[model samples]
Target: MWKILKYSFADLVRSRWSYVYLAFYLILGFSLLFLNNDLSKTVITLMNIVVVLTPMIGTIFGIMYFYSAREFTELLLAQPIKRRNIFLGQYLGIALSLSLSLVLGLGIPFLIYGIAQSSEIWDFGFLLLVGTFLTFIFTALSVNISLRNENKVKGFGYAILLWLVLAVIYDGIFLISLVLFDDYPLDRFTLAATMFNPIDLSRILVLLKLDISALLGYTGALFQNFFQGSGVFISLGMLVLWTVVPVKLLLRKAIRKDF
Candidate 1:
């Protein structure tokens, strides 16, 4: 598993698209920070970028990686290796490589600015966790989608659509719900909605750190208190679930796959 993961990581690093993507993220991160001189504004902009871009990049890269490696995957199947190991190795390799790039591309700038400005370390830490976990979640989902379809275009499209639904459409639905339920107590509903999408959870976590939970209304306050009371462990558990569930489903498919 370790060897396979290392090789997979190396392959990812050598890909031209990897460099392109890294440069794009780095430029965007620096640009956003430069445009917003205020720490709170900077954090909000960073969070928005993370919530929107990280998953899109993760999903597209993951689908492309697996589809491009179809031949390699087939060759590996011919060897005496467990399907679960191969799938997991590849998954971990992609997750780690992309997550590392994200940290270097976005995280370093955020840290430098945060430290120089004497900003809250907790917000920076939360951003790091959110970025990595968001990658893991999208990668896992993308791998599952890739394995389910033979056509690379179709698989990639499905992954992008899934991301759109979760990251963007879900928020729209929540907004509509809030408008419809203006007279009802919807804090619990909003909490449930946040749980359904990791992007929203990530936003809530960062907003809470800035002491702006009240702006989120009742549901935002609930999430703020939830994270504040539970801290890193809760977020870690959520992230672990995000990675584990989809990978587990994919592993079951891989083990039973005729190939």
Candidate 2:
């Protein structure tokens, strides 16, 4: 497994796309800091981009990696190695490569700007953490989609559709539902809804950490107050669940799947 993992990691790290991903982050980080010297404000702006963009990139990368490597993967399948190791290693390789791009891309700018001396270090770190979580979660989902669909086009469609629903459509539906039933109490409903969508849960979690109560409004305040001291921990737990379940499903499917 480690050997397979190492190979995949090395292979991806060497890809031109990997360098492009890294360069993109480097530019984004420098640009954001150049435009705004405020670290916290920069982090807030980044959170919006990270939450949506990371997942989409992860989804695209996951689908692309799995399909591109299909021939090699099939070759590996004929060997005595376990299917779980092969797929999981590939999945981890893609997720970690993307996470590395995000960290280095954003981390370098902040580090140079003196985030360590600033009060927003933890907030910045949490933002990166959330981005990493989103990457892993979406990568796992995309890999699962790829595993299920033998056709590359179909896999890409399903993966993008998954991202769209969670990132955009889900929020629209949630807001509409809230407006339609505004008269009734929605605290529980809101909380429950937030939990179901990793993106919403992550946004609320970061906003709560930033202590941006004004932006959080009613729902954010409720989450902050409801979770109280344990808000970050609870949200982290949910993100873990989001990442693990898809991974588990991926492993299971790989194990029983006919290559």
Candidate 3:
């Protein structure tokens, strides 16, 4: 597993897209900070981007890597190796490489800007943490989608559709439901609904950590009171579950796949 992970990560790290991805963040980080001159607001901007972009990138990259590496995967399968390790290694490699791009891209600028001395350090850190979780969850999901569908077009279609539903459509429906049932209490409904989508879960996590009272509003206040201490753990646990469930399904599919 380690060997496969090492080589897979190396392969992806060497690709031009990796550097492009890294440079994009480097540029985004510096530009956002220089323009706003506020770490807290900059973090909010990043949160919005990370919540939507990471999963979409993860989904596209996961399926792309799977199909692109078909020949390589076949060669690995021919050797005496556990099927799970091969797929898992590849999945981790793509996820980690993308994650590195995100971290280094954003970190260099913030560190230079003196985030260490700033009080928003934890908030920024939590933002990055959520981004990493999102990378893992979506990559695993994309890989699972790829494994199930051998056709490239269909796989890509399904992956994008999955992202769209979670990122945009879900929020649309959630809002409509809130309006439709405006008279009834929706505190628990809203809370549970947010957890169901990783993107929403991440957004709420950052908002809660930042403690923007205005943004958190009434519902946010309710969550603040309910979660206080253990709520962080609960949210993180759900993100972990989001990543684990898909990867476990991927492993199961890999094991049974007639590679």
**Per-model RMSD to reference:** 2.3, 1.4, 1.3
lDDT at 95, model 1? 88
In angstroms, how far off is 259's CA in candidate 3? 2.5
What lDDT, from 0 to 1, does candidate 3 have? 0.91
Worst ten in a row by lDDT for model 2: 211-220
Clashing pairs in 2: none
lDDT of 2 by residue, 124-230 (tens): 89889999999999999999999999988899999999999999999999999999999998888988899899999888878877766655565546755765567
lDDT of 3 at 84: 82
Query: Residue by residue across 1-259, what tens digits does model 1's lDDT show?
Result: 7888999999898888778878877887788878876666776777878878889989998998999898999999999988888989999899889998888887667666764456556676678788899999999899999999988778878998999999889899899989999999877777667777888777777777775667654555565576667744676677678778998998998898886
Q: Is candidate 1 or candidate 2 better by lDDT?
A: 2
Full-model lDDT for every candidate: 0.82, 0.90, 0.91
The C-alpha TM-scores of every prediction are: 0.90, 0.96, 0.96
Q: RMSD, model 1, all Cα superposed?
A: 2.3
